[model samples]
Target chain A: MSSATTTAPESGHGHHHHNPEDRLALLKQIWMFSTDHKVIGIQFLVTTLLMLMVGGALALGVRWQLAFPWENMPFFGLLFPTEGGQISPEAYTMLFTMHATVMIFLVIIPVLAGAFGNFLIPLMIGADDMAFPILNALSYWFMWPAIFCFGASFFFGGGPGNGWTSYPVLSAVPEAAPGSGFAQFFWLMGVTLVGVSSMMGSVNYMTTIINMRAPGMTLFRMPLTIWGMFITAILQAFALPVLTAAGFMLVSDRMLGTCFFIPSGMVINNADPTVGGGQPLLWQHLFWFYSHPAVYIMLLPAMGMVSDMLACCCRKPIFGYKPMVYSMAAIAGLGFIVWGHHMFTSGMNPALGMTFMISTVMIALPSAVKVFNWIGTIWGGRPEFNTVFLNCVAFVSMFIVGGLSGIFMAAVPVDIYIHDTYFIVAHFHYVLFGATLFGVFGAVHFWFPKMFGRRMDETLGKWHFFLTFIGFNGTFFPMHLLGVAGMPRRYADPYLHPYLENLLPMNQFMTICACLMGFAQFILLFNFAYSLFKGQKAGMNPWLANGLEWVAPSPPGHGNFAAVPTVYRGPYEYSAPERDDDHWLQTEPPKSSPVPEPPKPEPTPDSAPVGEDTGSSS
Target chain B: MSEISHDTGSHAHDDTHHYVNYFLIFIALCICTGISVLFDVFKGGIPKSALVFGVMAVAVAKALFVMTYFMHLKFEGAWKFIILAPTAILAVGLMIALAPDMAMHYYTNDAPQVKWVGGEHAEEVAETEHSEHSEHQHEHGGH
Candidate 1:
């Protein structure tokens, strides 16, 4: 292995001497079906970005229906000429359902775990590549089949309209709704395959992080990004199997004459009575069992990434690094038990609801710890206030709003009122779109230099951030008021009710803000595209960060590094007093003496000042 | 300095192969399965709760035998517990959480018992097949 490291310098430059034909072939090989982790990460990035547009368009359709109920809509209204450009009630159901489906399965999960997780994990941990490179590539390819299933659902009679939860009886009985026939089947298949892809990726991540670390890159010394990815992998591996099982059972009930979620003597859509005695609530149990932990799976990686970004932009060590790790683990663990909170309105036992409520509230302890620690990290440092810093701050601010609203839902009595209201919708958007997506936006800017050897236009990036933040708040904040006003979610036309008719103006305001938010993303897409070719060339270590990845070349070649980097201290060693430079690199040997032993239990903040580890070692 | 070169290979390098009687474990698993089946077969004689408990216990024993011997978790490091414990806890917790609604049948009477009538309108269907039991009305009172 050391011999390969020695010969890497010559082989790395060999690509430069290739003829035009060979270069084209090499480009085709790398971009098309390459198993390089970096290429796979970019593949996920591009694919999920496209899906984000699709999901956003679906959401805009949903908003249009709400703001101007039964009115002829633009763009989507063209598809429904029979209704004079107005979306049908059934189409409205499919709109919100597919919007959530694409955002969760296709966009957020893939972009975080599949995109950033793949690109950062091996580099940050000083590994050459993922533990299973072929399996990693397979994970990205498997997403297409899932995407195909989801896309195919739309053609097969309007798509699954039972919402992303797909609670059965409606989902199981094919004749139950306009979209329940083959569209629901395809949706189930899509979910199952997405679970399969996620399972594969999580297994690969766990193995790579556990076994493939370079020397001195111990579990504790690894970056919080790695810790978040590692814990998220564990959550995915444990929770995804249940979703896959539930998906299969639903498919069987619809297609294979099984009754896992169907009960007897129930006639839906004028069909013959169902004969099976299987319970509908059973699906809720199995689904939420996986889905509850999945909320953290969507979140913890961003939490991890935001911690790293906040420390970097703030020029401070993350406040209580070990505590942050423990809290993340605690969140994942508690995530499993608190799933019953989602089932409070399903006529679950009061005793069970009480148990779930307690666990759900207890989960808030870890979340609040993370929020406070983030604020603490930003407290005393001379902050950079760049695009990265601004987005990280937004993530913290939005997470507080999301986390506080979640507490209300955790209470049985409160949840009973707001269970199916727009309030629930607002709470999750703040978490998923507000917190997680903002973290992703920050990360994309922070790591764009490393991903493409170029920096995104900071001015453009900040504009994207501000528009998104303002648009996001304007769009979702009013939903809390709407929910309190007794506006139910998934309603095609709430204006039909006299009590809710007064809220039409508020809904219209929110829809306009949503359109602004949706269009502001084009600035990001343009920045990404324009910057890829024309943006300023960012030398390695552009951010002047302390992590091991800063030691690698910008847009690192095939194996990610010329040689495996050996870590000395933790990743967040910014602004140490002993060093003249503000940043330190993990691979830098101590200037005066050999690297000291890792700190003992009572770890001091300024204990290890290895060297003036400033320039790019690559 | 700890000079660790990249070694993308198998981490498990236990050369010492422990002797395990796989045939015996297999036979034990089969016997456990047979016992559970027998309990189910004679369920009429046994009390319903005892039959269920006895069969589930037997099934658990079989699973343990498979995981310990066939899956070689017994020979694995203590990390096996770290990995398996949460899953075990969650599985049990899920059962505990599900038991009240699924097993207890607490609100079975209030559960909607819909009948199919050959009609398009819901009002006509409701009038013909009227079994709209209120959720609070407990048809079966004190246990």
Candidate 2:
């Protein structure tokens, strides 16, 4: 920040203060776009939701066939209908692979990092906008071509079938499946775009958080949200390049015939494949290097959001705030080490597996600390029954369910048995999709009033919650049972065996539940669109939640805080008996606020009323 | 001009983030690359001892870079640097844990069985399972 210390003091308000009269042309602006973090967040939000549905539907189709093998699915043939009725084996493989890609790269990564991280980082840190606005917009726009390439996979006769890991031989050879080599290319290209987008977002976040805290808002005084975003960006900065490099190698192998992942010797389609002298496990090494930390990338920010939301709603000073901070740092550090947990069954040595297992178990400790801190923050505070509060609680509950099951995978022997089983599916979906997505939902709802100047329908929100909670569990929970009964995964038709027959009924039940979960979002869609106009008009601080965000004008004016807001006390100042207000705002100075000189009697008719209270003094 | 407050009172030229530091990184990287390459060559002659020392050098250099730059300790606070120091050690420690399994695969009498395609040029190399396994059909090799 120093070389630039004398750089140029910003216009502070210049970037955001341009009048509407001087607006850029629509087409021109769309091409070059505004660098407003809010705009970038919305861009991420809309794109990711569209992809989520497309991916979710794919999951339903796969589940549909597995529950009832050989049945007549709407399109793409049968499950194995002797000839054709539901999904084909190739289609099944394609479904599984594409579903994972859409969920992780499109849904989780963007929604967590791109959407929430972009929207909140600047606002939370009290900056007018990101450090580099144009670059931020470029990073977001870059995602479009990447997504287009990914969606193109399905139409290329089929999508990637290498199970999202895209291991060589299976992913490298054209004969690996009926899919056109397009799937591999699409996966590589999509991930590359995602990596690029992540890198840009990371750099922007790091720079903004470091350079732009409001006066008196020192590092410790900054809210946990900023802390989470900062660490996530740091992880992304170092980790994403490895994945980008890995994706390029895979791209070259598929399109240009250079084998970075394929080992020496092998044949495909009765012809010797040119892919030789490449290590299959090396791809795993590089991919997991980015991706395992990527899991933390997805989780930590949401954890940060959930932490803020819980403390705000419960009106309590964040319990053990410093410990919570320490835990986040610990988790990010431990995350890089535990990638081997994913590779245990990839033929890693038993000693290495044991070491990974120990490291994996250690991660649970910091996570446990975070969970305890959340619960402690809310323990005795008068709880609000608002949508945001409930969702925060839901996030914690889901996280607990998600975290506890991770222990199963943390153990070496347990993972070996359940390595590629539905059990693994159940465990991660609970963590990644269930817990993390719930955190996102809570954040959106919590921030909706602040973003839109309108409060969401509580009734509809509640209905949305129950249906999602039940449906998510119903959909993922059965996989645990099926996995236990030794029903092998990745099969288009599991009913091929009589022993697995009992699980089909459960599978069908799960599929039906999954569809119900899909429909539950329609309530959300209704809530989102309907609330835009007809919902109750929310003034600033609708929930009376305490944080700097509430103190800013509703919908937050061009610059975040009206005046420079200095921090007074910690983030969660709930039920501070010393104050009359039940919830304490972060920008509100403590009990003995200030005793300014007794106001001088004003002259006639208020010439220009002088001596206003300039925000707060810490 | 916009007013962005700078607290230069506690600030000085941060040697770690200064442009000059880039040269240091470059020099360090060259040395690391040199060490790795040297070890690889020496392993051809004294494989065991060179392999151990070479990796150790690369690991130390990488740890230094991460500590000084990515973690931004050289330009920032000791507390942050202290927090940042261990992740590199953790990553390499994890890698070491996996080394033995990779070692076993390389050393075991077992060789990767290469399946014959189109029944051409299938021949055995010193009673190996892979090159001549047209009819042998090892169990683990198929999947």
Candidate 3:
């Protein structure tokens, strides 16, 4: 194990002298089935973005019908040319259901946990690659069949229409809903494939994080981003199997004559009921059990990435690093028990509701701790106002709103009213979109150079961020008012009831804003594309960050580091009085020795700097 | 750093003693399966719920044997339990939350029309079905 800090740049370039024939074969390997973590990360990024576009298109269709009831859609209506281009109630149901499914399962989880998690975990922890490279590759490739199956669901009697939860009775009996038959089967198949992929990825992540860190890179010395990926992988490993089993039972109920969820003596579409001796509430119990932890699964990596970027740009150590780590762990631990919060309105025992409500409210303590720690990281420091920093700050601000709004729902009495309203919709988007997407954007901006060896234009990036911020607020913030006005969700037409008639103007406003926000994302796509070739070339340590990733090449090669780096201190070491530069690199050997020596002695607490002795610095 | 290069692979070892132990565990698992079958064969005298509980206990024991021996969890460090703890706790917690629904019957009769996803017309359908279901329950006793 040679030190990467001593590796020469010329040695890496010397490998380029291979013959053209060999080069072509190498290119094929790199593009097609390479097990390199960076390549897989890019693959996850591209695939999940495409899924996001598909899901976004569905959302636009949903918004269109809600804004202008019975009105003809322009470009998208051509896809479904029934009822003179107007979105049918049936189509609208499929749109929203698939939207939630694609976004939750396909887009957010893969992008945050799959793409960035794969790319950053090894690099930050000073590992060469994932512990199981083949499994890492399989994780990304598995999504292809899943994406295909999800798309195929549309052709087979329309897509799943009982919402993403696919509640039984509606999902069990094909006669109950239009898409309940074969389409729902495809939905289950697609979800099961995704679950398998995620579980495999989780195992790989856990093994790599625990067993593959560089010599001195202890668990506490690793970056918060690594911690984030570690906990998220654990969450995925445990939670995804339950979802897989639920999906299997669903398939059994629909295809086989097994009565797992359908109760006896029930009529479907005004016909004789066949299934017997099963509970519909059982499906809710299983789905939410997996889904509650899934909420943390989506956001934890983002929070971790945001923590890293925030510490880097602020030019200071992350405030309360141990607290940050513990809070995230606390969130993951509490996440599993609080699933019943989603079921308060769901006719489970009302006594259990009190238990879940207490657990759910207690989760806010850790959430608040994370928020205060982020603010503390930025306090009294000359923070860089780059696009990444702006996005991280926005994530914190919006996450505050998201967390505070969650309290309203955490209280059982308040939740009983807003359970299925647009307010619930508003609350989640603020967390998912406002908080998580902002973190995703920040991370893309922060790590774009490392991933692509070039910088995204800061001007375009900042413009994209501001427009998205404003558009996002305008789109979702009004939903709180609409919810308070008693507007029910999942309705294709908000004009169905006389009470909702007054909310039409606000609904139309949100749709327009949502369209603007949707269109503004193209700016990011353009920035990403154009910056790939045209932007300024980035150096190895362009940001002058403290992580071990800075010791590697800009876009690291087959093996991330020439030699796995030996860490001397924690990832974030900023404003140390002994260093000339404001930030200190983790890979840098300690300078206390009178003479610089080869094969430096491993850094122990006795000889390290003041901050290094803390043992928990990130 | 050189010493730690292959630390991840250190857990893999070929020990004959462990293999013999695994074989012994496998035999124990087989014996448990046979006893569970015997309980089922003589089901006339034993209580039905006790028989169910007995079978479930045997199944749990079998799963533990497989996980410990075949899965190599017995040789692994404390981190093995760290992984299993949350999954087991949450599973029990979910069952706890669901206990009321499973034990106590909530609704007097199954209202077939009152589907969660059946929307507005389903509610009206439920109104008609409610009256009919109550009469049916009066005649046949609730299912």
Score every model by TM-score.
0.87, 0.80, 0.87
Candidate 1's displacement at residue A483, Å, is 1.1
lDDT of each structure?
Answer: 0.84, 0.73, 0.82
Compared with the true structure, what per-residue lDDT tens digits does model 3 show for residues B15-74?
422554666887899999998999989999899999999999999999988997788777
DockQ for candidate 3: 0.13
For model 2 chain A, the run of ten residues with the poorest summed lDDT: A609-618
In the range A1-618, model 1's lDDT, one tens digit per residue, is 232112222211122222334324533554587788888888898889889999999999999999888989999999899889988888899999999999999999999999999999999998889988889999999999999999989887767899999989888998888655889989999999899999999999988987688877767898999988988888888888988888888999999999888888787878788877788899999999889888998999999999999998998999999889888888887887888899888988888889889999999999999999999999898798899999999999999999999988988899999999989999999999999999999999999877777789999999999999999999999999898898999999888789999999999999999999999999999999888767767766677788877777766767877776767789898999998878777876566655544423422213321110100000
Q: Which stretches of candidate 1 lie over 4 Å from their true place?
A: A1-31, A592-618, B1-14, B21-62, B110-143
Which candidate ranks first by DockQ, i.e. highest?
1
Candidate 3 Cα outliers beyond 4 Å, as residue runs: A1-3, A6-31, A594-618, B1-31, B41-75, B109-143
Residue A309 of model 1: what lDDT? 92
Query: What's the distance in Å from true for residue A215, model 1?
Result: 0.8
If you superpose only chain B onto the true chain B, what TM-score does each candidate give? Answer: 0.61, 0.44, 0.61
Q: Compute the DockQ of candidate 2.
A: 0.10
Look at candidate 2 and tell me the lDDT of residue B58: 90
